[model samples]
Target: MESPERARLDAFFRHVTEQFPAGAPVTSLIVTHLLSERPAFLRAMSATSAVAAVLPKPRSIDQHTLEAVQSLYPVHDLSRELFADSTRALDYIEETAGGQDLVLADIGGYFAPSLSTLVEKFSGRVLGVVEDTENGHQRYAALDQLRCPVISVARSPLKDCEDHLVGRSIVFSADALVRARGDILTSRNACVLGFGKVGRAIAQTLRAHDLRVTVFDKDPVRRVQAHAHGFRTAATTTEAVRDAELVLCATGNLALRQDDFAALRNGAYLASVTSSEDELELTPLQDLYQRVPVGEQLTRYEITGHYFYVLADGGAVNFVHGAAVGTYIHLVQAEILAATAALSHGRFEPGLHSMPAADRQAIARIWLGHFER
Candidate 1:
């Protein structure tokens, strides 16, 4: 925990503390995935703001992360985690706001579609939300009406840096899982669903490994873009998985469901690097398909007289080992911090907003100074 990134987060957050102060202590509900970098980030958040509660994303919490965040605030128990039952967590943390205007710094949109009642309960307004991931952004965007302004760093260029690197970490973990199964990816067929930043990186990395990579995206433009990038394009998810030995889902929107899983090649290695939605739809598989764990590497499933394997048991494979994607992730985390600064100051109206380009550039400049120096 004494690494340079801790110092870096402190400095980055200190810069934010100076650049934008709320004129009073800002009460915040932080929904975060507990990676190694999180404690430092949260500690810095506590140093600069009034924390209502610290909620961990289930499956991402580890013992070390738990120990680190334990002393910070009322870090919620994972058994009834925020994302699992957001309403209850919201109800519990509302008291901590002390009737002050509460702001949310969310990782996934845990409070989305569920915050109106709680916001109405607050004597002070629920100022706004700062969302970090595309999965969460989509959730908020889908809402026809929003309670407050939403500031998103998910589409920021700074976040794109994290997304691209996330793809590498995902491939690193998935390759390890495949090797754990006594196999390799070379000379094999791989299908990647979704051709956004992460999916594009995954396809490119797989090609570098000499895999025949095919990509499918519901957006016709992205499918064409994938084809232009020299990857084979599939017209449907079933078509994409029909012949590939390895299938990865980069879309957070449950790309592969029950019927889709029925089309996967026998013994295909399946993984997803997105949010906690089980993008490959593995829950019903337990009832419909026979599941057996293959040690710590992958879970084997039987469906349609064929077999398939899931890495990290249908969770994010990027963290199958750990969530560290080097010090670069702090850049994205810093942008999330900056979004909170906006929330504290009431910087937007009741609409969705991307991270300000000025804030994005300032964060990068600060990041370079913090790390390069």
Candidate 2:
């Protein structure tokens, strides 16, 4: 009904006054997600005004994916740290264990080949761990590591799965990415639509760039994080993008409904960093705008007096139009896993876990060394 830009502005003022009660500078906040896949979450941070950096995960990067990332940020692979104490059965092992030794074992739904190799290196030092579930015990039995001490990250899948998923493995360095998108920070407003890990990383990254960021999440818990960061939060998706000149949809959900984009500012760019362009659902708003053919696979639509450009059939604009920089950081992950395996030898124990901090530090050092060289 209203122009996208107008709607965005309304949402911005509402959130600024309502959600951001602390009066902290917009650039000081860094919002993050404790769950979900990485890439789709991080890019959404680009929409805000104070975003400084985007820290993403290895799974979010591929060789094809890396090119877009390289053009946007300096990428590196580093092991994440651990802050939880837990047990491991087969499932538990996969959830709580780390280093190369923990990835080799599997129980029903739990497994990580990455850790098994490292187990060999650690040999007797490594103790196999898993969940306490029957399935976990069955898996540990199949691997025949009953002789070793076992642990579990959770009592069952429903309880422990979240821990397993949230437990950090490999993360990408986003200092370069933040620097690359530096121009967007310090604007009046920005929007980040996903509240997962990558989304949080993007917000933090943008903040590092001296930008302020606004966050919206489907999960209510994530929305509360806005208060902690001293940034604004939108109660709904459309509200999140209301004030944003650059709207990035990281939710990997339908990006734009007719109602969402109808009133956006002219010359504003809708960016997507999700796995697919499914986020740009245009049907709801298309009815309001008159469309004229601009080019093959490209249609021009007018809203109010402004023109909005949707890139690559709503595919990832960063990937399609921007310079290609494939995921070299994944290669580093593989190397880390391999090196940990070699160090452990062939006698590793099974378990769930996070990556070793030492291993992560090693990767960071190596990357720094290479960059310095």
Candidate 3:
């Protein structure tokens, strides 16, 4: 495979940065997934100049990326501490800022537990927040009171490209896991739960690998889109999982709960592309069956004589094998970089805001020009 286009990512990130000048530089508490092209994006944004602390997600962050963050922002000792304990990461925000208000560059809305808690705990100290990821957007949107301008790129068209690539990465990891079990891909029919951008992409990727894919989503419109795209659609989650040998959850909510696993196909491979707790639950397995370890990241559990294999310990399967998506990682990171810079300007009022379409268009234009050239 070709190497990740880090040079293109660096250039594109710098281009995005140039569009939005950091008006009044403010100390920021940043949370991000430290993976391919991320370090280059941060360096291009001159992230250290405005960083107070950085909390790299434990699931996605690696030693090389951690070292890069260390070198980029050598001044902050808190960054390391926060990365170690993410709960403490949110707590540090409440304690620190030294007097000046801090900007929060959040990924996945890890800091925002709820609307009331966020408004109660971090109103004045946090001047504004720049958020990415659909999960984060939902968390911030539910909040009625806003003390700071919350800028998000989760719903932007620019992010959709990255989400599609993310779905491919999810499928890549799932295929690898199943293959590791000595199973052939074509022998199993796959079903994707959740027909959003990522879910649609997952279904397509599965189909590309010669798996007859069936998809299900809570949204009827998404199901219609899936059918229109030449894929099978299920009316309900049970209908989706009952016949498929491989079931992948892309819904960013608790999709497969304790009882829901009962509807799964016999000896099915279960995996998710989003948060483990949010997408799949293992309480039924833990309570009913003895844990059987088939592999380091794979587990086998028997329910009612039906065997189910859980991948990546019920966490995001895409993240199991480094989730290498080459240059695709840069598109979202560039939008995130731009959003951070725009939030740093502090021009937006205390409310939820989206990444401007103009900015997204500008980033996409720059991205296509650089990579496609």
Candidate 4:
């Protein structure tokens, strides 16, 4: 079989530039993708859009530098392929470290700044890890976790962070989490709050699977958009939760105040996709509200006649609980990001990297493709 890298690049050359004339005013193609394990790379991408951004490496190159450089050779088209290979490249890749306690880091889309934060927060706890890119080496000075140093593609103790956090709760293994997702998404009437990026994505994903969706947002335009998209839109977060069987907080705002719980119904599931669950002010809410634990990771918050179930303590439920995102989505997004960044002279840095322009375009294409079908 042709190498994934070769196939991806070949596809890029064959298809990525098909829109423009062979010699149109188009500039370059910037590429970026998810590295599965390394958080640093995603962080780097988030920090600054660079040109030819090698995962885990940093430089002062700017977008103008990319544009002035004539054309961009997007790295994601190749880097994602290379990154996917790194794990299988080493035999001892999955071996665990010295500690019995495991540390799972799910650094989504290795960009720079996010990756740096990963190095700072969890490198010391490294036992074994499944890094999706070569950037993992920058954070770990030694490959001590590799039991058989010479063997590539070996099992590493470092698990994907996404595999650990599920349904706003942490699971010890991927199997347990998978089982949980099977049950969670099957629940009736899930409510998604904060019609922002994460919220919208979650709602769309649920709807794609035929799950009933009701979205809430403070922004009038967003509410209108959600409603227009065939989702039930609520004017207030509290009202959205009132009828929801499950409540997902996707907003970046501090909306889930202690008093907010007072409005929730009994047995409703509450999960968050934002940065912090503490923003829910559970302690103050707990004072007046009574929530009970249901499943291993599920909680039941008793509010008036309703019981609200909270998952992952309101973290990014999809990231925490769901299985690996579909590879097709990842591939499309990575390719688009790479192409766009390259055109603008920015390299795809890893770690909380911004959604690449090409990837965004690709999303539009995918949506159009689906619509046309």
lDDT of 1 at 34: 86
> Candidates sorted by lDDT, descending order?
1, 3, 4, 2
C-alpha-based local distance difference test score of model 1: 0.79
Each model's lDDT comes to 0.79, 0.40, 0.74, 0.41
How far in Å is the alpha carbon of 124 misplaced in model 2? 37
lDDT per residue as tens, model 2, 1-373: 1366334433433332222131212210111111222232223222221223222332233455455544654443322221012222223323323222222222221332223433443322343333322333334445533434333322322222222222111011112222243423354455767655445655655555465577888879888875477667888876777667555565645556656775566645455553232467765555666776554324456766767645334544343322222222222322222222332332334333333445445544443433333
| TM per candidate | 0.94, 0.39, 0.87, 0.44
lDDT of 4: 0.41
lDDT of 1 by residue, 284-324 (tens): 67788878898585888976688988888788888767856
Runs in model 3 lying further than 4 Å from the true structure: 1-8, 74-91, 114-124
Candidate with the greatest TM-score versus the true structure: 1
| Residue-pair clashes per candidate | 1, 86, 0, 89
Check candidate 3 and list the clashing pairs. none
List model 4 lDDT by residue over 277-343, tens digit each.
3236676666665767666655666756655666655544444433243223333333333333332
User: How high is the lDDT of residue 183 in model 1?
Assistant: 89
Q: Could you tell me which 10 consecutive residues in candidate 4 have the lowest summed lDDT?
A: 148-157
Score candidate 3 by TM-score against the native: 0.87
> What is the Å distance of residue 77 in model 2 from its true position?
29
